[model samples]
Target: MKKIAFATCVHLGLSCIEEIYRIGGSLDLLITLKDEKAKDKSGRIYLDEIANEHDIPLLKIDNINDQEVLSSLKEYQIDWLFIIGWSQIAKKDVLEAPTLGCIGMHPTLLPIGRGRAAIPWAIIKGLKETGVTMFKLDEGVDTGDIIGQGVIKLDQNTTATELYKKVDDMHIALIAKYWHDIVSNNVILTKQSSADATEWPGRKPEDGEILSSMTMDETDKLVRAVTHPYPGAYYKEKERTIRIWSAKTDENDGEIKLSDGYLIPIDYEIEGNYGR
Candidate 1:
């Protein structure tokens, strides 16, 4: 069996992890991080679960490039490394450690959205369609040779929560569909064009603030882009900060506008967990 290594976070990493196990390769090593905020009854990330069930070696780290991490990874003798939901950019030294180098599964089509919060950024920019890509990792942020890609359509109403799931499904599908072709060296690696490469920084909690001058359509997209699983877009009102879980651009929609401007939010009430 060809030995392989996996790197990713637990909660969001399942889309790739479960399938990797199911595909039946020599997943002898798994590297992950501890998420303090995301919890479950089992108190284990999927990485821990997979390691326990399959007897795979597991490494949890704060820095993927730390000397200590490098030391431990060397023991795996891995032929390939697949990084799914890892948040940091892999350093060149580490990226070169794997015999075949590392593969990063980006949620957006590369040479376009190549940074943190690809889903939200695409939606906020009013993109009609955005997709996923499997690429070979390089020193630069997401500037990798493309292995395969698939598209997902979006509209004015696409929310971060919904897109998150769709991206997860695509991750699973891409791996299933292309694992053989990728591993056997039967695939083509398309070089990314420097002229088309785009990179943006990750989003923070404060970055979701909506501006008062945006058009109704723009504000609506921003709200949906950051709703639910993500921190909702909001603006300060008097002494309180109000978070917008959902909004609409259509004039005929049931949302009653209390005020009007280029784009301004109105008051409304919501019920239930509302997709918490």
Candidate 2:
């Protein structure tokens, strides 16, 4: 059996963990964000539940650079590391710790969309097609060599929730297809083209702030791209911030139609301190 280390905190991470177990890979170590209570867009509990259920040793680390983290990883003698949906960008020592090196799953085709929130970035930027990438971990942010990839088409109505799930599904599929090569350390490597590379910074919850100056189409894309799991897009109204969970372009010449469909705050049951 092949021994692998897994790290993640998002729904995609959960899926990868589950698939790793299903495929009969030995997950010797499972690393994740410090918060196990964090929920995905679908409100699923963090990876702790899976870790406990699978009897995998779980490490909730805030910083992968800590000396203790590297020591713990060496103890496992792990064949490879999967850093999908993890919180921190791992440093050099962490990447080189594992015998076969660290691998990450980025939502966009690699050498492009190399920063945080690649899925949302693709949608907000009006990309027609985007894919998930599994690549070797390097010193830079998601600048790893390609191991495998899977593509998906994006339509105007493709919500962030939907795209996230799709990419994860493809991610798991590719892992299954390459399970043998991964465990045996026998696989072809493809170098990413730096000439075609473009990088974007990761987004914060406040980056979801929406403004009226944004085009109806732009606002629609922004709202849908950030909806669920991530902080919803919002604008200040009368000193209260109204975070939009959903929206669309209406038949009235692409006018922005708030999913709320009401002049007053409906609360939308989103996670916030505000009341209707």
Candidate 3:
């Protein structure tokens, strides 16, 4: 039986871990972080159940690259390390420790949307199609050889959260469909071309702020890109911080001049002084 190691930080990681267990493989180790503000209860309990079901030794590492983490991974004699949604960067040692090396799963297709918030960035930029990729980890951020990829269509009205679910589904399918091929080394790996790849800088909370002077379509995309599950786009209105949760852009029939970063509260709620 192939011995595999699983590392993750959020719900995405939890799903992968479960899939690994379902495949009847041996989990040498399971590494995860504690989420302080989990909205879903099943996420916490699900991880616990999987750990118990597989009888896999579990490690709660505060930092991904901590010395203890490296020591624990080495102790397990991990053959493959599957990483999902891990925030911390994997050091050279941990990546190299696994016999078949580590695989990093990204929500966006390689050589295109490479960054932390791929889904949101893609939607905000009005991308018509996006997908997920599972690749071999390398020294650079998301600059890895592609093992497998799955694509999804993006509609004009698609919200970030909506697009996120499509990517998540694609991710789950890819894992289940190709886990065997990956372990047996039957999978085809392709090198990501540097020329066609575009790097997207991850978004900050402030980046979501819509400029008043921006066109209706641009503002609409921004609004949807940061809607529920994500921090909604916001702007200052007098002394209050208003967060726009839902909006619909309409064509301006008459002359209505507005400045950049204008707070047009079509539909919003006050997020307290700190902006939630």
Candidate 4:
């Protein structure tokens, strides 16, 4: 049996971890971020309970590339390291420590969408479809050889939370579908084409700000893109801000009017407190 280690600190990682165990797969170690280090991580959750329930050793660290982490990986003689829902990139030494190599799961199709804030970028770009990709990890960001991929169809109404659940489900299904092949060394690898590739830059909380000059459609897209499981898109007024959790352009009447049309805020939060 090949030894494996899993690292994650977010809901997606937790879902994948449970999927691994649910299918009778095994792990030598479970890795996660220190609680203090996880404050800013969206949908972050502790894995202590799951680890304890499965009797798997849990390792928490501030950085995945720290020397201590490298030592533990070597000590376990890990065959494969699955890094899911982790923000930090693994260094060369850490990537090479595992015999079969490190694996990463990205929310978008490899080569095409190969950078941060994939979920938001997918909606922001008005892509009708995106995908979940399982790939071998290398030095570059998500520029590794592909193991397998699952496509997700999107619509204008797709919100971040809805898309998040779809991606999470796809992750579980993909891992389960390939676990046997992976264990038997039957999983095929495909190189991503550089010509077809595009990258998305990372997003910050301030990036969610809604500008008054934006069209209603633009505001609606931004709101849906960042709503729930990410950050809420906001509109700032003098001395105050309003966080828009959900918005729709189909409504005839709305609180905020724009050049193209008006947007009805389905859910929102005022400066100091949330409002229904």
After superposing candidate 3, which stretches have Cα over 4 Å from the reference? Answer: 23-26, 34-46, 253-267, 271-276
Candidate 4 least-lDDT 10 residues: 250-259
* Models sorted by TM-score, best on top: 4, 3, 1, 2
Tens digits of per-residue lDDT for model 3, 1-276? 456788876787777667666775456788877545333533342356678877888887677787877788678877778887666789888788777789888888898978768878888889888899999998888898999989889888898878878877887888888789876767687999999888888778898876657776677788888887788887665566668877765454322223422224466877655533
Clashing pairs in 3: 111-197, 211-261, 212-261
Model 2 global lDDT (CA atoms, 0 to 1): 0.76
Task: Identify the superior model by TM-score, candidate 1 or candidate 3.
Answer: 3
TM-score of each: 0.83, 0.79, 0.86, 0.90
Q: Model 2 reaches what TM-score against the true structure?
A: 0.79
Candidate 2 clash pair list: 41-229
As a whole number from 0 to 100, the lDDT of residue 201 in candidate 4 is 96
Off by over 4 Å in 4: 34-40, 250-253, 272-276
In candidate 4, residue 148 scores what lDDT? 96
What would the per-residue lDDT of candidate 2 be over residues 65-117, giving only the tens digit for each residue?
77867887889888688887656678889999887788887888888888878
Q: How much is 33 displaced in model 1, in angstroms?
A: 3.3
User: Tens digit of lDDT per residue, candidate 1, span 64-91?
Assistant: 7877566766787776788776657788
Runs with alpha carbons beyond 4 Å of true place in candidate 2 = 9-11, 32-62, 237-241, 250-276
* Top TM-score prediction, candidate number: 4
Quantify all predictions' global Cα lDDT against the true fold.
0.75, 0.76, 0.76, 0.88
